[model samples]
Target: MGSATSSRSRASWLALLSAFTAGVGLGFLAHEYREVIVANPGIIGLTLLVVFAAGYLIRLAVRALRRAGSRVDTILAEELEKKPSPRPR
Candidate 1:
């Protein structure tokens, strides 16, 4: 369980890092293609719209994971409650 928690934490960190990297790369690419992007405002606007959607999805997924984690904790606590208590010495 400790390992599982650690893995999840690592995965979450990696995801955040990946998102940041992607955003940086995209920004650089946009800047490099500034002239073309400006000439075709529709294309640039569409691309940005897609990026915004991806960001929204990422936020939704993170929120869902947090909510699920709390539910898992509640379930684990309930299961532990059903176990017999240790006998007195």
Candidate 2:
């Protein structure tokens, strides 16, 4: 379980790094193509819609993970409470 958690953590960091790199690349692309992008109002609107939708989905996923983590912690605490403690010598 510890290893699994570590792996997940590593994956998350990698994902975050990848996202940052992608954002930087996209920024450069936009900078280079500013005129083209500006010329297409429809493209701007579509990109905005997609960005908002992705943001909304990411928000929902984060909320769900937090709720799940809290529920797991509560269950683990309850289970621990139910277990008898070792007797003192």
Most lDDT-accurate candidate: 2
List TM-score per model, in order. Answer: 0.64, 0.64
lDDT of 2 by residue, 2-89 (tens): 9989998998999999999989999999999999998998989998899989989998999999899999999999999998889865
Cα miss at 42, model 2 (Å)? 0.8
The whole-model C-alpha lDDT of candidate 1 against the native structure comes to 0.93
Query: Number of clashes in every candidate structure?
Result: 0, 0
Error of 1 at 24 (Å): 4.7
lDDT of 1 at 66: 91
Whole-model lDDT for model 2 versus the true structure?
Answer: 0.95
Q: Give Cα-based local distance difference scores for all models.
A: 0.93, 0.95
Query: Which pairs of residues collide in candidate 1?
Result: none
C-alpha lDDT of residue 31 in model 1: 88
